[model samples]
Target: MISEKDFIAKSSTVTIDNGSFQWSAPSNIALVKYWGKRENTNSSNAISSEQIPANPSVSFTLNHCKTITKLAFAKKQDQSSFSFDLLFEGQPKEEFKPKIQKFLERIAVYCPYLKEYHFTIATENTFPHSSGIASSASGMAALAMNIMSLEKALYPEMTEDFFYQKASFLARLGSGSACRSVKGSVVVWGNNTSINGSSDLFGVEFPNTIHANFKNYQDTILLVDKGEKVVSSTVGHNLMHNHPFAEQRFEQAHQNLSKLKKVLENGDLQQFIQIVESEALTLHAMMMTSLPYFILMKPNTLEIINKIWKFRNETQTPVCFTLDAGANVHVLYPENVSETVLQFIQAELVGYCQNGNYICDQIGEGAINLSV
Candidate 1:
């Protein structure tokens, strides 16, 4: 396991220069969701700048639906301040600047070149933003990949494992789920007794124990609402501070992770469906039961879920659903059942999606280094 301390040692020696790098990184759907954070005790339970979760999480990296980011670094004419031009889909997204700037500031210490160079970042997503898929996870991970690629160019001696570990660590600092985007098929983030090499700072690949059947699983995202959520994930996570069921929910997640690991290794689809659906419902339940309650799931979200249950019961297609922080439904199933499951989605579940739009995606082979 590469700890945070071990990962930062190579950053200081890198020499900065004009460089351009691009990477396409997939977004992940957390099978075991990460909802709340463990706050800094010295800060009165206030949310720390660090995005460490209260419980561990595991996820599947999705294909077809991903973010492609290109970053160009140049020596800053004015060394006094860091500067950058950020764009989304060839348009300026002023709303996203602050977040990106803050992320850059957070990682400046680990990659000193960030402070010395001006950056121009252009990013685009295959799927619509705020439609339940994690854009931040893919976006930040892609950006982190570009950063690490630049460092790798500066220091050719860096190992492939070192590049990914540092990139995951940097991505975690940007978005909690982003850390898991670096690993393929399945990735586990946060410390848990069920998996070795898992860390609170980054994610570890869950390849060894995973059954062959799960390697090619499909995820068809039913976009119930294309619009942004009423409450952001950050705000939702913060509400856990006063949540009555927070502690119990954390304990439940730990137990579920252990059981789910067994199911994953044994290829138990029945148990997989149960645990995945339970985690999705539990995630929304936490939100609804918060002190200031909020509901991200729409009427159609439940409608689609109920219909999936009906189809699965009738056909025994071995399909299941999981959700992120939004209303969309991620219908997960083995690739062997993809044809049947996708037909079921189009025939029954498509009506629930806004404009009947859904993304056909599957477990991807991690990120692609377009720079090479």
Candidate 2:
């Protein structure tokens, strides 16, 4: 079991030189969405600083929709505090600095070397900005990987498993979903009785034999609304604190994950569709029943969903949809049915998309160190 103290950096006499590292990490879509955080308490009933989820959630790590980051660091004479410059898509992005600054502060205890160097971080996304994809997940995971590369340079004997685990651990502090972006065709976050080696501290790859039917699953993201959400995910999660149905909802997530495991193992597409769609609706249902009671799904979002339902019922093509905390819909289907589904999407669903825009992606193998 990994503990919080394991992440703390020990003093080292080894001197490190200035260097640059680049990495790319992909965004992910949660099959069982993580909606709320635990009440900052550990097993011993003591206050804790770690990000712990109320329920375990699993996701498909996406290919193509990702963030690529380049981190260039130089040793500083005055190693008193953390210093960094942020750039987005080749231009200086001041608005993004605060988030990165907070991330650095959160992980500083784990990576003390940050204080000794000045960093220039340039990042860009494959998807459109504010397009409903979780850029924070990919961005933070990529940044964590680059930082891990720096750490590896300091301790060359680090094992691959430890390196990825620690990277996922640090990424979770930046964005909760980012822990899953560090690895995967499928990843699970939060501890559950059914899944071994799972922890709220980081995401673990789904550690069971997956049926071949799920291989190369297609995720066609329909751009229903290409604007920012009125309620950020963080705000939504906070609202769960006093939510009347929070407990029930959290329990439902665990049940759905258990069901999903069998579905994945048996290639039960019908069960998969039912659980995935119900989970998506349940996520929004929690939002609607929250104290503030806000909805993220737009009119076109409903329209697209209805169309998908009609198309599926009429043709039985095994295509279904899942949602993040946004208006966009992710149309998921097995690879074998890709041609027919793409035809249906283009012919029937394209009209509902914002500017007729959609992206084609699939499950991917986590992040890559481009500098390597």
Q: What do the candidate models score in CA lDDT, each in turn? A: 0.85, 0.91
**Candidate 1 lDDT tens digits, 113-221:** 6667888999999877756666899999999999998888778898988889889988998999999998667899888987877778778898466887897889888
Worst 10 residues of 2 by lDDT: 39-48
Q: For residues 334-364, could you state the per-residue lDDT of candidate 2 as single tens digits?
A: 9999999999999999999889999999999
lDDT of the structure predicted as candidate 2: 0.91
Task: Name the runs in model 2 displaced over 4 angstroms.
Answer: 43-48
Which residue ranges in model 1 land beyond 4 Å of their true spot?
Answer: 1-3, 9-16, 40-49, 130-132
Q: List the residue pairs that clash in candidate 2.
A: none
Question: Per model, how many backbone clashes are there?
Answer: 0, 0
Error at 174, model 1, angstroms: 1.0
Query: What is candidate 1's local distance difference test score?
Result: 0.85
